[model samples]
Target: MEGLSWSASGRDIVRDVDLEVRPGETLGLIGPNGSGKSSLLRCLAGIRPASAGAVRYDGQDIRGWSARRIARHTAFVEQATEAETDLRLGDVVALGRMPFRGRWRGPDRTDREVVDAALARLGLTGLRNRAWRTLSGGERQRAHIARALAQRPRCILLDEPTNHLDVRHQYELMDLLAGTDRTVLVALHDLSLAARYCDRLVLMHRGSLVASGPPGTVLTPGRLRGVFGIDAETGHDRLGNLTVACRGVARDPA
Candidate 1:
């Protein structure tokens, strides 16, 4: 996205953000709540129209593309999505195949295969027949991810995907994203997880781009204090991963 900006009720939620997510890389968007991370993701995915700026895919402006055409290239998983109907888990995930299906056609054999593979990819094959509403929060998250995977998009945009997941699931999800060959942009609140799993990090603050770089360079002690209002000690962990330990909230000098 180039010079991206979004506004609501005359107030800017996302301001003049220029970002380029590299191909085949996992890029983490980290910021405090309401810092416009989600808004940026929406603009990047072409879900929410940008107030000012252009979102380009493969060197062409995406604004000229149709919605379904955009869907074919980019998959987006929202922060919170729920299936209110009587849809089964598999059916919910099958929604991802809509972009690939023709207007008059239904799920063909290949569509079914893709859906099944997505379920298997997220370890949801065992629960494919379960009611969508009956699943736990983490399960719901996984289902959304599987749906994105089924889309077979070149770029995937996820907003706070780790919500409601346990510690193990969180790590597993990050690992999966990091290992994938597709370009991925994931919004996250956990600093250490982003630092450890993401090839690069983009930190947002107050509707502006605060910092963007590799984990080791962006996730620093002074940045932690200024950006997060916490005093943290940052260092590499035993396995050479970036680790951060927060001491406490920073106290302003008189």
Candidate 2:
């Protein structure tokens, strides 16, 4: 996106944001609450019209495409789940294949195969026949992701995907995202997980981008202290991965 901007009720929620994510790379967005992370994702997914600038997908302007066309190229997973239907897990996942199917037609063999594979990929095979409303929070989140993956989109936009997941699932989901060949843009609050999984970080503050680069460069002690208002140490772990530790606020002079 270049010079992207958005507003509502005369207030600019996002301002002149410029960003790029190469194919197969995972870019993590971090910011304080109400910093416009979710708004940015919504704009990128074409759910919210940009007040200015344009969003390009595969070198074409996304504004000209229909929602179904956009779904073929990009999938979005919001922070919450709302299942109004008694749809089974398999049926929910099969919905992702709708983009590729003819209108009023049922899924073919290839579509079923894709749904099955997606279920297995997310460890949802055991719950394939279960109703979506019966699953736990983490399971529901994973199921939503599986539906997105079933579409085989080139890019994905996720908002707080780890919200209800435990520590183990958090790591597992991060690992799963890191291993994918699709380009991923995710909004996250867990700075450490962002450091571990993201190839790059985009830090936003007050509706403006504060920093953008590799985690090692963007998540510096100074940047953390300045943007997040927390004193933190940054270093590399044994595996050469970036690590951060909060050391509390800086002391004031007497």
Full-model lDDT for every candidate: 0.85, 0.86
Task: Encode model 2's per-residue lDDT on 1-254: one tens digit a residue.
Answer: 32222222114788888776677889999998988999989889889878787788866777778999989989999987666779988888888898899998889999999999999999999999998788888988899899999999889889999999999999999999989988889999999999999999999987788899999889988878777788889988999888899899755311
Clashing pairs in 1: none
Tens-digit lDDT string for candidate 1 (1-254): 32222222114888888777678888899988888988888877777777777777876777767889989888999997655879988998999999998989999999999999999999999999999889999998999999999999888899999988999999999988888888889999988899999999999888888899999888888877788888889988789989989898889611
- lDDT, residue 35, model 1: 88
Model 1 TM-score (2 dp): 0.93
lDDT of 1 at 101: 89
